[model samples]
Target: MNSHYDVVIIGGGMVGASLAMALKNTALKVAVIEPYPIPDARGEGYQPSYDARSTALSWGSRLVYQQLGLWEKLSEHVTPIKKIHVSDRGRFGATRLAAKDYHVEALGYVVPNEWIGMTLISALKTEPNVDFICPARVEGLKRSEQSTCITLSKQNPETGEYDLEPQSVTANLVVIADGGRSETCQKLGIEIQTESYGQHALVTNVTTSKHHGYEAFERFTENGPMAMLPLGESDGASVGCTDARCALVWTLPEDEIDAVMAMPDAEFMALLQTRFGYRLGKIEQVGTRHHYPLKLSQAAEQVRAGIVVVGNAAHALHPVAGQGYNLALRGVVALAELVSEAAGKGENIGALPVLQRYINGRYADQDKTILFSDKITRLFGDTSAGVGLLRDMGLVGLDILPGAKRLFARQAMGLGGTEAKISS
Candidate 1:
C-alpha cells in the first residue's frame, strides 16, 4: 500500500473535479481515482456543437465555477435563460421569474454538460498538488482507524476492463463521489434511503420556428411537467440561417415509457409538440431521445471518521426543477470551504471535526432541495383534478404576489437556504 495522503476522492465527475480544483493551490496532497477520463478540453473559445446533454447552471453554481476559473472558458456556449415561465394548461395558473426583476444579468445559463466537464478537466490539468489517476479501476477498499486503503488496477482500452496488476494507496480521508449507488459508499457500510418515483424522464433536443430567446418554460401537463431550456445551436443547422433549438425534459409514467420509446419518429415528435405547446412554434425536428428512471436517494450520513460523501453520492434529487447539479455544487462548495479553512489553520485536514463541518454545513441545503424537488414532482406529476387545481392555485398566487415570486426565485437559484453560506 502507498503512504497515507491528505485526501483521496473516488470519482472524477463534475463535483469531484470541482472539489479537486477548488483545493488545487492548497498544501494538501489530493488524489482522484476515476474509471473514466474527465472531458476533452481542445476547443477554440467553445464554439459549442449541439450537445445532446446539458444542465441548468444556477447563479450560485456559476459563481463557484467562475471562482474555479472555468466559466470564462466555456461561457460562449451557454444560453442565458433570462426568464422562467411556469404554468399549468387547464388552470388559470402562471408565474414568471425575470432576470431583470432579480437585478441580475440573467436568472441562469443553460450550459452543455460536456462543456462543464471539459472546463473542469482543463482546470484540473493545471494543479500540481492534485494527482488524477483516470483510466484506472478500483479493485477493493479497506478502512482502518487512521486511514482508508484503496486498491486500483490499470485498465485495458481494448478489452474495456481492468488489468489484474494491482496498486494500493491510503488516505486520511476517502471521499466517495462515485454517484448515487456508489460501491465505495456501500463498502463503507453507509445506508442510502431511496424512493422510486416510478417515472421515466425523456430528454431530447428540438428545433423550433420561434426562438426561445433565452427563456425557459416549465409547463405542467397531465403526464408531467416538461422543461424546455434554450440551446445555442440546432441539431441540424442550415447555411445562411440559424436554427432555434431547445432541450426538452419530459417526465412520463413508467408504463408509458416503452410505448414512447417505440413510437415512430413523426409520432414521437407530435407527442412532444403537443405536450410542449406552440409557444415556441411548431417543433421542426427532434433529436435522438433518451430516458432515465426517476428516483430520490439520500444518504443517512455524509461523514464517518475518515470518510465523506459529496455530490450525487450524498443526495440524489428529482431532476424536475433541475436542482441536481446545483445542489451538488452547493455541497462541493461547502466541502471545499471547510477543507480550505481547516488547512489554513494548520489543522488535520481529514480529521472528524473537518468532515463533520462539511456534513453539518450541507445537511440543511441538501435536505431542503431533495424534499422540495420531490414535492414538486409529486405535486405536478399527479393527474388528479383536485391536486392539479392546488398546484395551479399555488402558481397563480405566486404570480400575483411579487414578494412570493422573488422568494421562490431565490430558492430556485439556490441562493437562499437554511444551510451555512458556502461562499462566505
Candidate 2:
C-alpha cells in the first residue's frame, strides 16, 4: 500500500465515494477509508449508509450525476417525480408544482440508497487513481505543516476483527465525508451545533390501490408532515410482496412512534390512510417500517489546516426538504474543483489558504440550505391555528403566483443561488 497520497478521504458512503469519483481523472492520488465491508449482491452486509431508505434526488443532483457520467447507469433504477403536491391536511390551501411549469421533464427522481451504494462502489473499483481501504478504520488523525497523518487498522477478513498493529497513511489533504455522527470530527475537537426536533421519521414502502402517476405528495397533518414519494412499480419484492409502491416518510412525535410501530398491518394502514387521505388511494400493503430520530447539526468549522470536511460531517439538516445529501453533493463538487485547481497549480491541496477558498465558496449555499430545511421542519410541524393559517396562505399564494412558484421550484431543484458547473 502507498504510504503517501494527495488526498485521503475518511468515509466511503455516497458523498465520499462521489468525491473520489469526481477526482478520479485528476492527477492526484486518492484513498478512501471505510470501516464497513463492501456489500454483497443481496445487500445484506455491513455498510451503514446503504440501506433500504429512499432518497429524493433534486434536479440539481441529477445534473451532478450526469456530469459524473453516472446518470445513464442510475436513471433506469430511479422513478421520476413529475409533480409535487403540497397541501395542509383538511385545509383549503394546496399548491401543485409540475415539471412542465419549470420547463423540465421531471421535478426530481426517487432512488433507493442500496442501488446508489452499489453503483458508486462498482464505479470506484474501476478508477485507476483511487484506492479502496474497505473494512479499515481510522484510529487517529494528526495534522502537520506539510500533511495529515492518518493511522488505520484493517479488519481481518475471516473474523472481522481489526489488526492489533496500525499502519499510517500520509496525505497532502484529508477530507472527511463521514455521516453526521462523526467520531473523527469529535476526536479532532470539531464542535458541531445541534438541535433535536423531538420527532422521529418512520420510513417504509407501501402499495396503493391506485397508480401514483409519478406524483409526490407532501401532506402536513396535525401530528407532523408526511410525504409519499411515487415509486411507480416495485422492481423487486421486499418482505414477500410485490405491488405498486410509494416510499413513505412519516414524521411523528417521539412518544407516538412506538405505538405506531407496534400497530398491526391493517391498523397501521388504516391510520396512514386516515392521515394521508385517499389521494393515492387506499394503503393496501406496507413493508417493514424503520424509524430514526431527526435533528439539525452542522460542524462549527468546515476547514482547518491540512483538512476539510464535507457531507454530513459538515452539515446534517432535517429531512423535511430532502436537502441533506443534495447540499453535501454540491459541497463535494466545489471542493473537488478547488482541489483540482490547486493540484494543477502545484500548490499544497491541504494548505490553509486552499481549503479556506473551498469553504468560502460554499458558506453561503450551506447556510441557506440549512436554514431552509430547519425552517420548513419547524413551520410545517407546528399545527397551531395561527401557524396553520399563515402556512395555508403561503401555500395558496405559491399556487396562484407563477413567480413565487418558480422561485420555490428553483430552490427545491437546488438551482437557486450562485450556480456551479457541477450543479448545472
Candidate 3:
C-alpha cells in the first residue's frame, strides 16, 4: 500500500462514507481509517430487519444522497413525513406543517440507520480510488509544513483496545468524523464545548393500533418533548404491524427516566399512552428502549492547517428538531465539493486558507442551526407557567403567519439558511 494519500478520513460511518463516495471518480486518491469493519470482498448488501433503529432524513439531505446516487436504495425502506404537528400538551395553540403547503412531495423521510450505513459502504466498496483501512485508530499525529503524519494502532478483538502498533501514514488533509466526543479531535487540540440540556431522551419503536398516516407528532408536556415519527411498512413480522409503526423519542427530566425505564412494558405503554394521548390509538408494543442525555456540543476549532472536522465531530444539536444529521450531511457535501475544486486547481488543499474556505461557507448555517435547535429545546423544555403560556402563543403565532411558517419549514427541510452557500 502507498505510504501517503491525497486525503484520509478518520471514520467510515455514514458521514465519512458519504464524503468518500462524493470524492470518487475524481483525481484525488483517498483512504478511510475506521475502527469498525468495512465490507470488502464480502459482497455485503443491506438486509431489512425487524425492530431496527432508524433516522430522520430531511428533504435537503435527500438531494445530497441523490447527488451521490444512494437514494434509490435508501428510499426503499423509508417512510415519507407528509405532515408535522407541533403542540404544547393541554394548550389550545399549535403549529402544523405539511409538504403540500411547501409544494414538495414530502417533508422528510425516516429510514433505518443500518440501511443507510450499509448502502453507503456497499457503494464505496467498488470505487477504484478509495481504500478502506478497517479496525484501525489514529493513535498519534504530527504536522509538517505541508501535511500531517498519523500513527495507527489496531484494536484487540476480545479486549477492544487499540494495543497493536501499526504503520504510520501521511496525508495532505485529515477529515475527522468519528463522533462529537472524538479522541482524534482531542489529540489534535480541538476542544468540544458543550452545554448540558438537563434532560435525557428515551428512544424506542412502537407498534400502534392505528396507522400513522404519514404524520409526525412533536408534543410538549410537563415531562418533556416527545416525537412520534412515522415509519414505513417493510414487513409485518419486523414491527408486528405492517402499517402501524412509529419511532419514539421521548425526552424526560433527568431524575425521572430511571424509574420510568424500569417499569414493565405494559406499565410503560400505559404511561406513554397517557402522556402522548391517543393520537396513534393504543400502543400495542415497544422494541428495546435506550436512553441518552441531551447536550448542545460544538468543536472550538473546526478547521486548521492540514486537518478538518466534519459530522458530529464538528457539532451536535438537540434531536427534537432533527437538524444534527442533516447539518452534518451538508458539511460532508460542502467539504467534498471544495476539496474537489481545490484539487482540480492544483492548490494546497490542506493549507489553512483552503480548509478555512470550507468553514467560511459553513459558519452561518452552522450558527443558525445551533441556535434554532437550542431555541426549541429551551423554550419547550421549560416548566414555568409563564414560559408555557409564551410557548403556546409562539406556536399559535407560527401557525398563523405564512411567511414564518415557510421560513421555519425551509430551515427544518435543510434547504433554507446560508449553510446552502457552502459549495453544495
User: How far is each candidate from the true structure, as Cα RMSD in Å?
Assistant: 3.3, 1.9, 2.9
TM-score ranking from best candidate downward: 2, 3, 1
lDDT of 2 by residue, 1-424 (tens): 6999999999999899999988987989999999998776566567778888888999998998898889888786788889999999988889999998778989989988888888788888788899888789999998888998999999999998899999999999999888899989988999998989998999998999888888999888888899999885433344553336899999999999999999999999999999999988878989999999988888999999998988988988877788889999888888888999999999999999999889988888888888888888888877788998999999999999989998889888888774557544
Candidate number with the higher lDDT (1 or 2): 2
The local lDDT score (0 to 100) that residue 86 gets in candidate 2 is: 92
User: What order do you get sorting by lDDT, best first?
Assistant: 2, 3, 1
Estimate the overall C-alpha local distance difference test score of candidate 2. Answer: 0.88
Query: TM-score of each candidate?
Result: 0.93, 0.96, 0.94
Which candidate leads in lDDT?
Answer: 2
Across residues 71-114, which tens digit of lDDT does each residue of candidate 1 receive? 78768568788999998866777899999987888888888766
* lDDT (tens digit, per residue) of candidate 3 on 320-400: 888999999888888988999998899989999999899998898899889999998888877888998888888889999
> Where is model 1 more than 4 Å wrong at Cα?
1-3, 42-51, 157-161, 234-243, 418-424
Report the C-alpha displacement of residue 330, candidate 3, in angstroms.
0.6
TM-score of 2: 0.96
Cα miss at 300, model 1 (Å)?
A: 1.9
Winner of 1 and 3 under TM-score: 3
Could you say which candidate leads in TM-score?
2
Poorest stretch of ten by lDDT in candidate 3: 42-51
